[model samples]
Every structure is written in C-alpha cells, then in structure tokens.
Target chain A: MTDKKEVFGMRFGQTAGGCAAAVLVAAMLAACTSSSTSSQSSSTSAPAGSNGTVIKIGVELPLSGGDAANGIPTNNGVLLAVEEANKAGVPGGFTFADDSLDDAVQGAHDPAQGAQNTKNFISDSAVLAMVGPFNSNVAKAEIPLTNDAELAEISPSNTNPGLTLGDDAKKLRTSHPDIDSYFRVCTTDDKQGAAGAQFARKLGFKKVFIVDDNETYGKGLADVFDAAFRKAGGSVLGHEHLTKNQQDFKALLTKAHSLGPDFIYYGGTTVTGGGLLRKQMADAGMGSIPYVGGDGISDDTFLKQAGSMANNSYYTVAAPEASKLASAKGFIAAYKAKFKSDVGPYSANAYTAAKIEIAAILKALQADGNKLPTRAEVRKNVAATKNFVSPIGNVGFDANGDTTAPILSIYKISGGKAQFVDQINLKT
Target chain B: MDIFLQQLVNGLSLGGIYALIALGYTMVYGIIELINFAHGDIYTLGTFVSLAVLLGLGVSGEVHGFTLVWVVLLTIVTAMLLCGIVGVLIERLAYRRLRNAPRLAPLITAIGVSFILENAMQLWRGPTPIAFPAVIPNPSLQFGGVEIAAKQILVVVLAFVMMAGLQLFIYRTKMGKAMRATAQDRDAAQLMGININTTIALTFLIGSALAGAAGFISGVYYQSTWFFNGFEAGLKAFTAAVLGGIGNVAGAMLGGFVIGLVEAFATQFIPQGAQWTNVVVFSVLVLVLVFRPSGLLGEALPEKV
Candidate 1:
C-alpha cells in the first residue's frame, strides 16, 4: 500500500512536469510562428509608389470570432477608405497600403494577441496609424502598448467612457501617460447611456430593471444608465449582472418579472447575452415590456436572434442613420455593391475613422512639403482634427480625444429591423 | 408566497437538467474511478448534432402541435444515439490504453479530449452563440397565481422518466450486474466471465446518453447554445457530483437538484443574487464537503490493495 501511494505520487509529478514542458514548448512555437508571419506579411504589403515610398495603416480587429459580424464589415470599411485614398493620392505621393491583422485567438478577442498585434504594428516603421478593435475590452489591451510607442489608434466602435474620460480615464492615464495617442470616432457609453435613459423617460418607463453582461463595456454602460436614470427622476427597480455568452436567463428574468418593472434595459452586445436575454424575457412572460440597450445591441444579429421579441425593443447608436446622411448615400451604395451586403453597424464609423486618419496624414505631409512625416507628426495631426466633414457627420476630436460630433441616434425595432426614431446631440 | 413557489418551479426545472448531467459524472466516476471531464463537451456535441438534425428536418420558424413534438422527439433520439457512440469511442480510443497506467493518465486524457471537442465545435460553428429556434412553443400554465411554462414541464418530466429508466437498468439487468461487478473489481469481474470492456463501454454509453438528453432539453428550452456552454455546465455538474458523493448515482441526482435550488433561491432571495449565483452554489459545495466529507449518500469505497 505504501509503495502504491509512492508510485501514485510519482506519476502525478511526472504528469505535471510533462504538462508544464508541453505548454512552454507550445508558447515558444506560437511566438516563433507569429513573429515570422508578421515579418513576411509586412514585407509583402509594401506597395511601390511613384517615389518608392510606401506607408501602411495597421487594421486590428477580431476578424474571425464572435465579433466577426462587426469586425469583418469594419475591416471592409477601412479597406474601402484605403482604396479611395490610394486613388486620391496623398500630398507626398506615398502609396497607402492596408496591413490588416486578426487579433482573434481561439475564436475570441484575446488581449495577449491584441497586445502582440500592437507590438507588430509598432515594430513596422512604415505603418503610421491603426483603426480598429471593435470591442472595448480589446481596446483596453491595445491602448497601453500603442500609448508607450506613441502610435495613434482610432477605434470605430469602442464606447467604454473610461477609455477616454472619467475616473477610469484617470486610472488608464496613470498607467500609460501618453493618453492622447488613443482616439475613437464612436461616442462613449456615458453619452449613449444618458441618451438611453432620457429616451426611456421620454417613452414614460418609470421603473426599469437593468441587466449587464458584467464585462468592462457592458457593466460600465449599465452603471452609467443606472446613475443617469436615477438622476432623471426615474426609479430603478433592480440591477443584475450576467456572465457573457450565457444562454439561460430564465431565473434572472423570472426574478425581474416579480419586481414588475415598466421595461427592461440590457447593457451588452448581441453576441454576449443581449439577444438571448430578450428571447428568454419573452419566454418568461414579459414579451410586452419594451427592451432598451446601447449601440452594442444595435445590430442585425440582435434582430435575428431576438426574433419576434425584437418588435418593441429600442437601441442607441453613435452614428446617424445611413439614409439620413446625404454624404453616406454614396458610401452605403458603394459598400453594398462591393460587399454584396448592407453596411453593418460600425462600417460607416470605421470608414469615418479611416478618412480622419487619411486627412491627418495629408495634413502632416503638406506641412513637411512633399516629405514623409514621422509617426509623431501624424499622431499630432490626428489629435488636432477639427471641423472635418465625413459621411457620418462633421468629424472632429475634442480635448479628451473623443469625437466632437457625439450624436446618439435612437432606433426602435420594428418589422425585425432597427428603424430610426429620434436623435440626441450630446454635449461633449 | 407565489413568488417563492414560482422561483421553486424555476429552480426545479434548472435542477432537473443539472441532475441529468450530474448522473453522467457520477456514473463514469463510479466505475472507472476517473472523472470524465470531457462529458460536458459530449453534452455540447449533442446540442450541435441536435441543432443540425432540426435544421436538416426543416423545422424552422414557429414549429407547433404534433410536428413540434415529433421533431423534438426525433432530435433527442438522434442526439442521444450519436453522443452515446462518441462517448464509447472516446473511452475505447483514449481511456482504454490508460486504464491501468496511473490514475493521472486517464484524467489528463479526458481533459485533452475536452479541449479537442471544444475547439472542434468552435471551428465548426464559429464561436458565436447561434440562436436556437424555439421549437417548443412556450405556453405557461398558471396555477394558484404561479406560472410554469411548457418547456419547464417537458424538461422536468423527461428528466424524471430518464432517471427512473436509468435506475431500473442499473439495478435489474444482467449487463447491469456486470457493470456493478466491474465497478467493484475489474479483474475479479473479468474472472467471473464478464466482458469487462463491454461493461465499461456500456457505462460510458448510458452516461453520455443522459448528458445528451440534458443538452437537447437545455438547447430547446434556452433557445441558444455555444461551444463554451459545456465548460460552465460541466464545472457546475461536477460540483454537484462531488457534493452528492462523487461515485454515488442517487447522491449525484440529489446534489444536482440541491445545487439548482440553491442557485434559484439565491437569485431570488439574496441581494445581487444573480451575480452571486455561482458564488452561492460553490459555497454550498464547500459547506457540504466540510460537514459531510463522504457526501450525503456516499459510502466510503474499500481501499484497493
């Protein structure tokens, strides 16, 4: 019996040792392959201009994961802007090429992979700016690295208020003091959340139950909504946090039903429990109550997943309706003709971000008089962007590196599509 | 009181599903003395297969009445059969060789199988949570100011029937006797003319079938399933198994229901319970293990010489 115990212990030790060795080897191999691939791609991506100067803009997005629905369209938008810029030509005659990187590892936005992609972008001297990282969590990881390198990154759809300004903003700045390096065309959660609260009050929902996916973006938005709703003379019945990607919300919904709230508010994207929560709420006999959410739930995926339950739901988006904007008509038609699909949620914002970046690059080039501007010069130009007109609206960056034109468009789900209801111009 | 009763019904329905999964964990662990960690992924695979079958049968957009019943029944059967075969194959290919080669070998192999199954499903379905069509039309039956949906009824009834059937099969048949004997002593059972390999395979087959049923019910009831669904469910079910006594069949079932009730009541009564549901459930496990180490129904197994 003693010998048997000893042998068992030995075997356990061997297994642990073996597993450790295997993990270390796998890590090393992954690093080696990623480095090699980045170098090869960078070398091949350099397009030959008239003067032999090629500039690349790194596009980091979760191209093949749960966020792919948003990421792929956003990538296409960036690609379209780059195509147009190449055709239009920069002042220095430098060729613009897109070096798109998929920061998704194991079918999700992995922070380590996002950080690695940032490093790859920083290492390549010709790459000037980056546009991407649809999800706020991925933005959180990539921002610090870009900040340290003084590389400018503009996200089309990161709505977490903490990333730009607020108490969390101060915390973020303390970690990476180069806070101005990160910019987003998309409005923050505070504006969207406050807009949603005002809309709820406008719709006369007195008591509301809030549920969040408990991630950085969802929880932050929910907190903002909760505070804003209370301050607006609306009573909050209850607040609940749910695990992301959780299919079942019956128990939570059942509890919510008992409270008898006027409506339900979800703070998360469609992929992360928003759609299922709506469906389950309907299943729990709350089908008639209107559901409200931020821009995260303002997508075709939410409409498809929520099915019939989507009818009375409302969501807020940072951009105006594509049809409403005269400048967006051309981009929308071109996007449809090229992609064979309607422009997704962040595609227009991504296009606007790319255009903004291109305009900054042009400014830098013209300042230097037909000479290539340094990355720092490009970063400065991007920060100083003001009164620049784009397809979305008048694009500009404020003191906090947030968009000056922060418009929150509310859409109601009717006929299984998000229809424009009202628009709120938020004060920066 | 109505709210409490309503929460009870909700808890029971959720418990029923967990009980079904916990049975698989207990049964496999009882016989092989190895925790089959891949069992949850097997449940996930069952949901995927059922989803594919339902889609193939063109059961889309508001399936109702007899057609709904038939489609659901057929999907469950197909999912169970496929999952059972897969389970047996996993046991044969992976666990068979490592049966006597240290306890750690089979355990590690089970985890490895789990990763393979999860990654394979992710590749096949693309990491996003696919909207499972609500095949079972939800019609709540109101009684005494409490609401109980048809899906909950279906889940509870089917789970009880499966559990009863499993109870009978394990205690009353020749194959069942062989299985019991193998669980007691594998070499000794082989000497008594029992086909040890077949008995072990049968154990895996039955356990996986129950998990498959669980997967089907959850997918249909919740109207969504993702690749990582199994991991969380598996962890909870494993907790149930340990709570009930890791190797006791009845204990596992009881533990599952207990955990389910705990989670439901926690969400209903505790402040911020929805966020603390997992915390409460695991706390119950810790408390139970502290008070009753051998589990509520577990009899300490005789030490092997």
Candidate 2:
C-alpha cells in the first residue's frame, strides 16, 4: 500500500511538472506577442497642419520575404508621398497619419490573415483610406473585407486582371456587384503580358521556353503571355514549373537547355529563382541567351542575385521613364531625397496611389461645412473622383475603379540598370 | 561527350557525400535499433562549428588563401569531436531513459529531439542561407581520360575508411564484442556484466562523428548552408538507410551508393518537361519495398520460443 502511494505521488508530481512547463511556454509566447505589438504602436501619426485633426491611414506591404524586393520600395514610396502630403497640408488643416505593416513575413501570404488585417483596419475607424496589400492574392482577400466595411483601398502594385474584371472577360460593371471598394493606380497584367508577347515576337524568337514560379501573379501573367505568344504563331517549347526555396536547378536547366529554345520567358519573382537560374544557365554554357521576366524580376536585387546573366534579362512594367513624364520630375526629386533605399520599378505608381487617395480625402473634407467626413463618405467620394491629375499623369477611376487603359513601358538592361526601351499603349 | 562526362563526375562527387551521410544512419540503427533523426542536424551543426573555427583562425576569401585548408581540416576535426559528444549526450538523456519503455517512446523522443534541435538552430542562425568560404581552390584532379575532383575522391575514401574502421572495431575489439552481445540479447548480456549503457554511447559517438565529417564536406561543396538543410538531407539519408536494409552495416553503404547513383541517373533520364526526379525516387522506393520487404541485404531473424 505504501509502494502504491509512493508511485501515485511520483506520477502526480511528474504531471504537475509537465503542466507547469506548458503554462510557462504559453506565458512566454503571450509576453512576446504583447511586447512586439507594443513596439509597433510608436507608428507616426499624420501631423495636423494648423488644426489638430489628422486622418491615419494603414498600408500593408511585403517587406521581408519573396515580394520584399518590390514591396519595400512601394512601401517607402507611399511613406514618402504621405510625408509630402503632410508637408503641403490638406486643404482644411488636415494631416495624414500612417501605419505600416510587413506582410512580407508569413502572415502576408495567408488570405485569412489579409482578411483579418482588413478587419483590424476597419474596426480602427481612424483609418480613412488604405494604400495596399501588394500581391494580387492578398488584394483578392482584402477587397471583400474593405467593401463590407465601405473602406477605400488603392493598390500600388497589384496587377491581376480579375480584380477589376470578373471571371468573365468583360469590363467591370458597377451594377454587376463585386468591385467597388478596390482601386489600383497601376495597369493590369493583361496589358503587360500582351506587350511582352509582342516584344518577344518582334525580337524574331519563334521558339520560346515559358517558365513560372507558380504564384498568383506569376502563373496568371504566364498564362496570358503563353496564350498571346501561341496566337502569334510562336512555338512554345514547353512550360516548366519551379518552386520557391529550391536552390538546385541543374536538372531544370539541363532540361531547358535540351529543348533548344531561342529564348526563355520567366513569369515569377526573382528572390529564389534569379540566382539559381543565372548560375545554372551559365554552367550550362547558355549565358548569352536572352530571358525576359515580368515586373517581379525588374529590381536591382534580382540583378544582383542573377549575377552577370541579369544583363541578358528584360522586364515589362507600367511606369514610364521619369524624363518621359513632364510632371513626374518634382515627385522623383522629392522621392530620391526622402528615401535612402534604391527606387523600385513601381515607385511612381505608389506615389500616384497615395496622391489619388489624399486628393479624394481632401475633396471630401472640403465638401462638408462643419461636419467631419466618415470613412464611408470618403470611400463614396473617392470612387466618384474624376479629372484627378496625379504625378504619373491624368488619373481618374472608371466605374470599376481601374485606370483608363494605361500604357506599359518595356525596360531592358542597359549598363546594369533597367532603362526604358519602348512604351506600348494598351488603349490602342 | 566531355560535358556529359563532366556532369557525371560531378554527380558522382555529390553521390559520395550522400553515401557518407547515409552510412551514419545505418550504423546507429544497426546497433540500437532507433533512427537518429537528429543525425543530419548534427551534421549541419558541425558545419556551423567548422565555419566558426574557420573564421576564428582568420581564414577568409580575402586572407591567407591556402592556409585556409589547414583551418578547415582543424575545424572538421573539432566539429566531429563535438558532434560525437552530442550524440553520446542524446543517448544518455533521451534513449537511455526509454530503454525498457515501449518502442514508440524512443521513436517519439527522437522526433521531439529533432524538432528541439531544428528550432534551436533557427534561433541561433537567423532564417537565411549563409555562404561558407571554400577552403581548397584546386578541388579537381585530372587522371587518364577522366578528371576526378579531389574533394569527391576524399569523401569516398574517407567514408570507406570509417566503415572499415567500424567493421574492424566491431569484430575485433572487446567493446565491439560487448555491443554485439548486448544487441543480440540485452538482458542476457547485462547478466554477463557487460555495460549496455557504455556500448550504446560508443555507438552514437562513432555514428555521429562520421555524420559530422560528411556535414563539413557537404557545406564545403554546396557553398551555402541553412538551418533547415539538415532536415531534408536527413530524410534522404534515412531513406538510403532503409533502402540498404536498416540494421545492416554493409547494406547501408550499398543502399547509399545505389540511391545516390539512381538519383543522379534519374536527373539524366527524366524529361525536363514533367520535372519528376523526386517522384521517380519515391516510386522506386515503393516498388523496392513491395518486392523485398527485408531490404536489399536484410535478413529476417527466427523468433525465439
């Protein structure tokens, strides 16, 4: 009986110890969660010019992971525009407050987290306008949440054609019900893909190897390019799929080399693929062959990763050269002074996005005599915006909140930097 | 023909390193009958330690170019010794306590230890691939019509030497005899006054030391290393161990060599279109299991009544 009692005592002791350990771990996690979140609370509020009223706006960008290369620049540009807006002052003594989140971490890719992030902004009530959710998938997740809350969101870099146009290939109808709270200052992937295909065909490449990193934007753009390329009487050698985080690509490269295509078209971000593709292509002794990628690989980091072979890669993007846009000179000068980091391929689009949002907000605040404008009113007013001239040129949303058929610029590697080659207007 | 041969030689070189890692898995399972999931991570940890040693010795791409080789060798030795100690410690803390417990207990403990090691590694090294400086610039050796790499030859030679040493020690030494006696019948061997605990620790020490050497070589070859490198490589090595016939020493070496060669050949054969090299490897494994349940060389022991 004493032995049994001692055994029972030891068992109880062990169970209590396990429970204590579990609780300690949970407590540590809770502590970390609280402290990290508190540090982010030091986010700067938009300065109230002469009056004390400021509108705080939240912007989500992927600043760390696969999308970090472009997303960080877009975020920086938005922040720069916000700073400029505060400097100029909103018409009736109003200032813009800014809250930034790094969606580049794991949470950014998850649609559930994107919806939750949108819900968090909606509940804040202080956030009158939102700048982004950089990737198209995140944009898709956030659109409904924003629409439900009647919040206005301007995406600086999302290029999915379906965001504005529904699954059917027709232009978005306001009465069709699906897209009201979403607006993008940037041109969609449909325009960019068609331009890339035309450029590839013009280059006299009859056979092409199409590859994608299997992402929301990468695959969608690849599908567009492939269809257009095929219709142009070009033989698609094959479409190869490479995954993210895979370092070894000798097998894929060797296979790609075997197909003996004149050119390779990659539809993906360059975080993982750039260096591997470059190194492998060089090893396969095909370093001279030209490869074209989308805006995802149009950054300097991608070039750095791709090494010397980056010299042969070209990308198509929406932004025209700063010299080409007469009004963009001042915005460019201010942006360069404000941001110490390298300018992204889509920095102009970001500045334009922030400018449009500030303009709509200012217009709404001016309309009311003594009453403060609610977020819902701001959303309706921003949607109804017309003849709003932005830094990039004339910007006005159609019923679907998309830019009126903008042109895309083809950028080629000239002396290690993406220089303007030509511009194709999708409107034609 | 030259490029094809060159790629083949490169494939062989990588195969040798995989085989060495696979040997570590086979030896540990051969003695204690537990798959040491932490073995590959031990290899990764060994590489990190080697990097610290290289940096500590002032061996960088910028300075004392050839002397870096000596520093790398020193680092490899120190890493192997440290890994050997870690292996023994794991046996004492985890497996030893579960010696008389259910079979599932030790397996679960091994998995738990693997996760603990992986997460701890992530904490130590941030989630980024750090480039390791190459010690030997002249890794190639041209002979007859084939140009063989010194690093590849070194890996294969060292792997065989370790296996031979292990084989001799097991068959000839007093501790080896005791280990075999314990493995064959644990309680009976304990009655005969053999220390089962020491034998188990010795097995882990030797097994982990071999894995440590392979890890150092792997880091040198790949040029980049990450915290998660161990998990993927460990899984491959485990598969190699089982393919060769788990708990069989010779079978492990054979399994490692076969898996390495087949993976290389699969890359050569599989169309670039589908990209099904990994799928092919798993498919081969399934077919092998269906045909030979006891593995290539594994023998089924008769039940004692």
Quick one: best DockQ, which candidate?
1
Docking class of 2: incorrect
Instruction: Give the per-residue lDDT of model 2 (tens digit) for A142-171.
Output: 776787777889887666667777653133
Give model 1's DockQ, 2 decimals.
0.42
Cα lDDT, model 1, residue A389? 84
What TM-score do all the candidates reach, one by one? 0.80, 0.74
Highest-lDDT candidate:
1
lDDT of 1 by residue, A112-149 (tens): 78889889999988788999776666677777777777
